[model samples]
Target: MPSPTMVASFRMLSSQRPFLRHIRHTPHWPGKWPTVSHARQLTTGSRELEGDSPQPERPKRRQKLRKIRTLDPTKLSPRDYVDFSMLRQPNVELVAQSSDLNDASNALLGRLSATINARGIRDGKFPPNTAGFLYYHTPPYSPPLAGEVRFRITPSPDTASLSEGNDLLTEYGIPWKIPLLHMTDKKGYTGLQTLLLRDGLVTPQLLDIATSISKSVKTLSRIVGGA
Candidate 1:
């Protein structure tokens, strides 16, 4: 067994060992020591305020798009991607509604312009009475005629003007041809009539006309000024 003095001496040295080791190993920073960093990411505003080590620059926020990218055309919205109001409706008809005589004249020209009618299909030509004039239909009214509709303002080419001149042209209809559906008669006008009939567009009026050509002539005359 060791003496009490020696035992006391050993305990004293053992206690001092830890203290000496800590003094020798204590870390010393050469410059100002750093403070605790934030647990969350810091932004430019935060860096300015906190004065801590700079965080990695935050990725820029994504930008928005004018239009969505998609394979489906039906999903597209025309109003968004395009300048909707900026588009021109050149093919659409514009006319004065107050002109009764002008409107009547246009109606007659339209009837004459019929290439496919109750009578059948004719050579797609405007009649001789309509020769000097040209006709156009408002796209909205002329197409897929869900019900009866009116013709557009007739284009009268001035006789004083030519295609080369503005003054010499005076026809109300165009020289260019437009394909239109017409009616039929008992005689059954042309193959186009059969096609339209097969397609079921030769409405009840034409069937009546076919059943009674002379009888329906009055209805025709009333509508077109002559059978």
Candidate 2:
């Protein structure tokens, strides 16, 4: 009963039904109509939007370094105690005046040299009385002497016989007097006194001789000890 043109138009409408339904369910469509190109454009736009979405970037981690501490030599005060047993043989001589090569008093020089040498050899140790030898050259230039004149021991070359008294017994008698020679002042005593006291009481002359011998012994000890 329908006309031919109307029937053709109905067939065309039936063919587009699926497309119309698809467009009706799609988002952002102008109307219930669809085209192949429009569908392709929508799919491409969706892909582009997904690609442009932002994602969080991860944070970078840093490496930790270790701290180092440095030492200060000046701030480090090392207290050193000298061992006499390790002393080597020392050069010994008595001098009368202060000369370039001969600047030490004969008696003082002889006494020191002998004392240091003998003790080193006999006891295999430096006599405690002569401990001052290690620090004789150290400062403060003049240390506490218990209110006595501070004398600095210097090296000398003038030779003198023990039998003949010299400046040591005359002018510097306080330091050179025999150990038995009593003095009100304790500061005037020499290393020989202490050494003798440790062993036993002896004549001042004998102590002096012994001290000189010790100095000689110390010089030999130094050589042998080193070997």
Candidate 3:
């Protein structure tokens, strides 16, 4: 019951199959089909080209070190050395036996060493030896060589200096002791040695001389009294 036109169309399509098949089998790239060896060579060539191409250089990695903050000895609390060992002379052998004590000692020493190197001695450098018997030594403690000796070190500003009401001399005009200079009767005292004991002027050198003089005076007094 097929229509004449439909039947004719179907026959035309069937007749074109062989032509289509020939077209499909023909190489579309204008060459014969590649053999197994030719295919291998093509793949190897592509690989070689890839290998020969310049590669991007990787960036060098650097190790970042952590910067440690230094500890301030002045800021250290008394509790830090509460049960801590480390004491004077002949008993020096008994120092830093415990792990806590040892760690504390090492930390203290390291900080002290760094501090001394930074600003301890004269411009962080030792003085040149004048005498033949000058001792190059380090003390167990570093005290303020100049200025008034203070037992307590705190970050808080001195309240006495800050207080306006504390200035009694300014308000009441109170009398204060002043430094005195004693002169010998001799007109030209070439052998006279002057010493200053003001809080600002007193130094270790002056202190040592004063101590020796005091001892000598006491010894002389004792001898004279016995006579």
Candidate 4:
């Protein structure tokens, strides 16, 4: 038979067995109970990782674009300045006395004067009422005139005047044999009448009266400012 002291000791050990199994089965440190210092170190490491966690990346700031300054063409030097007067003027009178004048202006004046003198053109006028004229930045508007075709003129090829003039002749169905002007007779004024008739430039009855006047006049010299 067992004594009372042995029985009491066995009962106490049985009660502690469950507590020992619970400690062994805890998942915190696998099979071991965590020490106070080690638990504190783990807690501190977790806090550090949280503190060092990367925040959401901020968006990059866009750089501002540079502002470009606009240049005024008129504000430039006189030679470089673009003259807008040609757009408004029906007839531009050019004098090459000033060196500051643009090249086109000077060239037009010289060329037109030379052409007029060479052709014995008394009045700075050609047949069909066309005359050489200048533009803002361009050479003389060849076939150059400020009449009906002045505003219609644009920058064209080197032979544009000749070509357009030919086209105009074709449009009017005028034969090439008719001289542009007559040095002696009134054929040029008569041709002008023909052109005016074809293009309907003026009323028919009025043109007929003008034609009669042109025929009655002895020479174009008086009309063209020549004695």
Number of backbone-clashing residue pairs for each candidate, in the order shown = 34, 20, 0, 2
Error of 1 at 153 (Å): 21
Which segments of model 3 are wrong by more than 4 Å? 1-3, 28-52, 65-227
**Per-residue lDDT of candidate 1, residues 1-227 (tens digit):** 89999999999999899777776666643234334452233355566688666779889965232221111222222221211111111111112112456544334322221221211113323233221222222245443322121211122333232232211111343323223322333232233233333334444565454446545665777889743
Worst 10 residues of 4 by lDDT: 66-75
Q: What would you estimate as the lDDT of candidate 4?
A: 0.35
User: Which candidate leads the pack in TM-score?
Assistant: 4
Q: Determine the C-alpha RMSD for candidate 1 after optimal superposition of all C-alphas.
A: 22.1
lDDT of each: 0.33, 0.36, 0.31, 0.35
Between candidates 1 and 2, the one scoring higher on TM-score is 1
Better of 2 and 3 by TM-score: 3
TM-score winner between 1 and 4, please give it. 4
Clashes of 4: 2
Q: lDDT of candidate 2 vs native?
A: 0.36
Candidate 3 C-alpha lDDT tens digits along 1-227: 99999999999999999988887677653246778998898899999988997889999874322111111223222222211011111000111112454455434332221001111222333222210110011124633222111112122223222222221111124311111111122212111111122112344464455446556666798999999
User: What tens-digit string does per-residue lDDT give for candidate 4 at 1-227?
Assistant: 99999999999999999998887887764676668998899999999998896779889975322111111111212221112221211222222333655644345333221111112222322334332222111125633111221111112323244224331122234321222223113432332333233333344665455445545564565667774
Tens digits of per-residue lDDT for model 2 on 1-227?
Answer: 99999999999999999999888777777665658898898899999999897778898864222111101111111121112323433332222222445533333433432222332134343223332112111125643221121111222211111113221212324342222222111233354343233223334555455556556666798999999
